[model samples]
Target chain A: MQRAKVVGTLWLSSAIEDIRGFKILILKDLSSSKGGYFLAVDTVQAGVGDEVFTVSGSAARQSEATKNSVSDTAIVAIIDRVNEENI
Target chain B: MQRAKVVGTLWLSSAIEDIRGFKILILKDLSSSKGGYFLAVDTVQAGVGDEVFTVSGSAARQSEATKNSVSDTAIVAIIDRVNEENI
Candidate 1:
């Protein structure tokens, strides 16, 4: 899992049928120096500016939230706080 | 899933117990212009310089090859060819 902030929503007029009804989000990586961003399916109903934990790859499809979906990226958790020292 | 080339192997002296016995690989994304790389567990026994398809996130843990493991990345298939026009 990676820490990220939801930046915006992606409204696709046409997408794979397996992804119907899932909210697609644009996420900015919080830990990368390159400021990488990627598209992810929101399962926790994360909002713009919310801190989230995203799972990428096939694991995205195995989550209870995104099961059977063809998503490669999925927001799996909403972070309440981050204590760097504990990590 | 993403297409990547296996560049190297990761030898971890200490890692989570759930990931034991899995070969950790360094993969370079073939489609990304940034030439990004990440660690992945190998299930298909891909070798260095092999072209492989990787599954990421929680789905990585659900594959028959990596089930019950704590890996976040797993190489699921070795690609023999890519038919771009058919895609």
Candidate 2:
């Protein structure tokens, strides 16, 4: 998992059949500034500016909310705080 | 999914319970020059130097090879070619 910030929501009039019910959000990787942003399915009810931990790849499709979906990324948790010393 | 090159193999004396039978390989993103490398479970029998497409998040765990595993990344397919003009 990686830490990211929710930047915005994506609205698609037509989407792949497996991803019909999920909310897709834009996420910026907090660890890198050069990679730009990527879209992720929101499962934790995160909002813009919220710090979240995301799972990518097939692990994203395993989320209960995205099961059987074609999502390649998903917000798995909303981070409350981080302490670098303990990491 | 993203395109990446298999770099090397990882030998773990002990691993997380959910990922025991999976073979973990190092992957470098083919699309980026600065992101370094990350670990991915191999499902498609990829070898070092092979270009492969990988799935992340829960979708990775849903693969027949990684079902019930805790992998956050997985190699889903081996790429044969790319036609950028048609993309």
Indicate which candidate wins on DockQ: 2
**Candidate 2 segments exceeding 4 Å error:** A1-70, A73-87, B85-87
Question: Against the true structure, candidate 2 has what lDDT?
Answer: 0.72
**How do the residues A11-76 of candidate 2 rate in per-residue lDDT, one tens digit apiece?**
543233454566766666786757555667789889888989998766776767877865787899
lDDT of 1 by residue, A40-76 (tens): 9887778999887665666566656666888887776
* RMSD (CA, angstroms), candidate 2: 9.3
> What TM-score does chain A reach in every model?
0.90, 0.88
i-RMS values of the candidates, in order? 10.7, 9.8
Instruction: After the best TM-score superposition of candidate 1, give how far the Cα of residue A12 lies from its true spot, in angstroms.
Output: 0.8
Cα lDDT tens digits, model 2, B4-44, are: 78999998877878778788999988644465688898877
Name every residue pair that clashes in candidate 1.
Answer: A56-B56, A57-B56, A58-B56, A58-B59, A59-B58, A59-B59
RMSD of each: 10.0, 9.3
